[model samples]
Target: MASAFELTRNMTIGQYIPTDSAVHRFDPRFKLVAFGVLVLAIAFCNTYVGNLFALAFCLALFPLIRIPVGYGVSGIKPAVPFIIIIALLQFFFSGSIAPGGTLHFEYGVIRITGDSIRLVIVSAMRFVEVIFLSSVLTFSTSTTDLTRGMECLLSPLEKVKFPVHAFALVLTIAIRFVPTFAMEMEKLMKAQASRGAEFGSGEWWRIIRRTKDMFPLIIPLFNLALTRAEDLILAMESRGYVPGEERSVYTRYRSKGADWGLLGISLALAAVILWLP
Candidate 1:
C-alpha cells in the first residue's frame, strides 16, 4: 500500500475495516459503480459550488456509512503535497493572462495571471475531490469484495480468449496481500526499534542514518515473504489446486434492481457532467 496517509498508511488493501453497515451490505457492484460515478463527478465538476456540493454530500453520507470520519480524512494526507505541486505547476503554465493586468511574484519566477491562478485553484479542488472520494471508497469497501466484483464484471471478456479469470485471480491475489505486506513492514519496524532505531531523529541526514541501520531488518522481511510464498505454493499444490480451474465461488455476488438503478443514476450523472457548461 506504500501510502503516506497515516490513516490508511499502516495497512494493506486486504485489511480494510470490517463492518455490517449498509455500505457493506449493498451489492459490491453497486458500491463500485457508485464510487466510479462519484469520482467522475468530482473530476468533471467545473465550479466552486460543484466542489462544495461534493464535500457536503460526502459529509452527509460518510456518517451514514458508519465509517470513522478521521480515517477517511486522514487517508488523503498522503496526496496533499502532490495536489499542491500540481496546482502550482498549473498556475505557472496555464498560459492564461489578461491584456492589462500586472504580474506579481510570491515565489521565484512566479508570474501571477488571473486565469492561471484560477486554473490552479480549480486543479487543487479537483485533486482534493478525487483523493477524498477515493479514500472514502477504499475505507468503506473491502479488497476481497472489490476484487470479486471486478472478476464478475469482466467475466464477459473471457469469450475472446482473454483469460479473464486468470486476470481476476492475479488481481485478487495482489489486493489480498496488501495488508499482509503492511504487517510485514510493521514487524520490520519493531525489529529495528528493539535495536535502538531512532525514528524521531529530526535531521534528514539522521533519519537516513537511522534507516540505514535497519537494512538487516529489510533483508529478513524480504526473505520471510519469499519463504512464505514458496510455502503457500506447496500447500496449494498439496491441495490439488490448479490455475485456471473452474470452480464455484462461495462469495458470489448478484446484481439486483437497486444496483441497476444505481448504475442508471451513475450514467445519468456522467452524461450531465460531460455536458456541463
Candidate 2:
C-alpha cells in the first residue's frame, strides 16, 4: 500500500513544476496556441523523417524547461501497454499494405506487411510525441494560468452567447481534482489494505478477488468528492463569487516580444514539419 501511494504520488499529470525557465515564463495563452499547432502537426505527420523531427522537438523542450528527460519520459510509461496494443492491432489488422508488398509474417487470418509495419511505427511515434508534448504543457503551466489562459482564449466565443467563463472554471476544477482524487484513492487503498484487503498479490485468484473488493472503495470516494464540491461551493459563495459577474484577476498576463518570438518559432517548425517531403 505504501508503494502504491508512492507510485500514485510520483505521477506528474495534472501537477505543475515550478521552474525559472523561458518556457515556464511564457504566457499560457501563447503556450496553449503553440501546443495546439504542434499537436496538429504531429498528428498529420506520416513519414519517418517528420516523426523524427517531432520527437526531437518534444525531447528538446524538457531541457529548455529544466525538467529531467527521464521524468518527462516516465509520464508515458503508464500508457505504454495500451499504446503497444493499439500498435499491434494497427500492424496486424489495418489492411493498409500496398499491393504486391513484401510480407513479413502471416497466420491463419492475420498478416504482417512492410507497409503495415511502417504505419505502426509512425503511429507509435505520434502517440509518444503527443503524450510527451502535452505533459510538458501541464508540467510548465499552473492551474491558475491554465484556467485564465483558456478563459481569455475562449472569451471571443461570448459573442455567440457561450458561457466561456463558466466553462473555463469547470475545466479548471476538473483538472485540479485529478491529483486530489488520485491521492484520495491511494489513502482509501491503504486503509483497506490495513484491514487485510490485499491488492495485486500476484495470485490469479487473489487478483480476481481484489478486483471485486475494490468496488467498495468507489462509493466512499464519490461521496468524498461530492463533499469537497459542496465545500468549494460554500467557500465561493461566502466570498461573493457570482457566476457571470465581471471579476478582475490579481495577476494579469501580458504577452512580451519573447512570447511572440516563441510562437513564431513554433509555427515555423510546425510549417516545416508539415511541408517536409
Candidate 3:
C-alpha cells in the first residue's frame, strides 16, 4: 500500500530537475516564448507527418537538456486514461469524415470513420507534444526562475495599469503548490489506509465506493490547501510584502548567443512545420 505513494514520484510536471545543460541555462523568458511557439505549431499541425515531426522535435529536447528520456515521458503516464478517453470520443463523434467515406464500425447513430480515426490520432499526438514540451520546460527551470521569467515577459502589461507582479506571484504560487499538494494527498491516503479504508479493492462496486469515498479526501485536501495559503499570506505580510510593489530582483537574466541561436532555430522550426503542406 505504501508503494502506491511512489507513483506520485513520477508526477514531474510541476517538479524541477536541476541540471547543468544548455537548455537549463537558457534564459527562461526565451524558453517560455519558444515553448509557446512550439505549442502553437503542434496545435496547428494539419498532417500526420507534421505531428510526427513536432513529436520528434519535442523528444529531441530531452537529450539536449540532459534530462533522461524516461523522466521526460513520466509525466504523461497519469494522463494516459484521459487522453484515451478524449481520443475515443473524438473518433466516434467528431464527424470529420466526408459523405460516402469508409466506415469502420457503426452502432445505431454512433459510427467510426477513417477520417475520424485520423483526427483522433492527430489529436493524441498534439496532446503528447504539448504535455512533453511543457514537462521539458518545467523540469529544466526552477520555480524562482519561472516566476522571474513570467514577470519579465508580462512586464509590458504594466504600462496598461495591469497588476503584473501580483499576477505573476499568483501564477508562481499556484505552480509551486502542485508537488506540495501531491505530497499532502499521499499522506492523507496513507492515513486513511491505516484506518482500514480500502481503496480500489478490486471489487465490482469498488469504483462507485471509491468515488463516494473521495469526498472525504477532497474536503480535507481543500482545508489543507487553504491553511497553507493562509500561512503563506501571513508570512509574506510579516516580511513587509505588498502586492503590486516594486521589488529588486536578486538575479538578472541575460540572453546569450546560444540562447539567440536556440530561439532562432525554434522560430525556423515553427515556420517550416506550419508551412508544411
Candidate 4:
C-alpha cells in the first residue's frame, strides 16, 4: 500500500547515486560550468536535427557516468501527462510561429504546420535533454559538492554585494530536501492509510477523485516541511552560523586535467549540436 505513494522510487533528480565514475570525480565547478553551457545551447536550439543531436549526447552520458539509463529517465514518468498536454497545446495553436512554413492542417483558429511540428518535437527533446543532464548532475554530485561548486561559480557576484554564499546554501538545501520531503510524504501517506484514508486506490480515469484523495496529504506535508525548516533554522543559529559570512572551507577543489577536458568536450559538443542543420 505504501509502495503506491512512494515518490522517491521514481524521483531521481535530487537523489545521488555514488557511482564514483569519472563524471563524479570531475570538479563540481567544472561540471556546473559545463552544465550551464549545455543548458544555454539546448534552450536556444529550435531545429529538429539540433535537438536530436542534443538528446543523443544527453542519452550517451548515462552510460559514461555509469548510471542506469532506466533509472536515470524514470523520473520523467510522472511528468508525461503534463508534457503531453503542453505539446498538444503547442501543436494546435502554433500558427504564429508557423506562418511561412508548410501548413498541415487548419480548423478555424487551430492550425498545425511544419514549423509547429518542429516546435513541439524540439521542445520535447530539449525538455528531455535538460532533465537527463540535471539527473546526471545530481546523481553524481553530493549536496556539499553542489553548494561549494555553486558558491565558487557565483563568487565573483559577491564583489558586487550579492549574497552568493547564502543563495548557494539555500539552493542546496532546497534540492537536498526533495528526497527528505518525499520520504516524509510516504510516511504520512502510510499513516493516513492506516487510519482508513483512501489514497491512490481508484479508477485511473477518475482524475477529480484522485486529486481529492491527495488533498488530505498536502496539508500535513506542508506542516511537516515547515516544522523541519524551523528546526533547521534553530540548529543553524545555535551553531553560530552567519549567512553571507566568509566561511572556512574544509574541502578546497582543485580541477584536474580531465576536468578541464570534460568541460572542453561539453562546450564543443554544445557548439556542434547547435550548429547542426
Which candidate should be chosen as best, given TM-score against the real structure? Answer: 4
TM-score winner between 1 and 4, please give it: 4
Compute the lDDT of residue 27 as modeled in candidate 4: 95
Alpha carbon lDDT of each predicted model? 0.65, 0.84, 0.82, 0.86
Model 2 per-residue lDDT tens digits across residues 154-199: 9999999999999998998887787677778788888888888765
- lDDT string for model 1 (1-277, tens) is 2231122353322445666666667787677778778787777777666666566666655576676666555545545556666776877766645787555554555666776776777677767666555555555677667767877778888888787766876776666665566667666766556677644344433434645655766778788788878887899799887878876777867777877886786677556555545
Give a tens-digit lDDT track for model 3, residues 61-94: 8998888888778877656767877987888887
In angstroms, how far off is 56's CA in candidate 4? 2.3
Please estimate how well model 1 matches the true structure, expressed as its whole-model Cα lDDT.
0.65
Error of 3 at 52 (Å): 1.9
Q: Kindly indicate the candidate among 1 and 2 with the higher lDDT.
A: 2
In candidate 1, list every pair of residues with a backbone clash.
12-178, 12-179
Query: How close to the true structure is residue 177 of candidate 1, measured as C-alpha lDDT?
Result: 64
- State the TM-score for model 4: 0.90
By lDDT, the candidates rank as: 4, 2, 3, 1
What TM value does model 2 have? Answer: 0.84
RMSD of 2: 3.3
Quote model 1's TM-score. Answer: 0.71
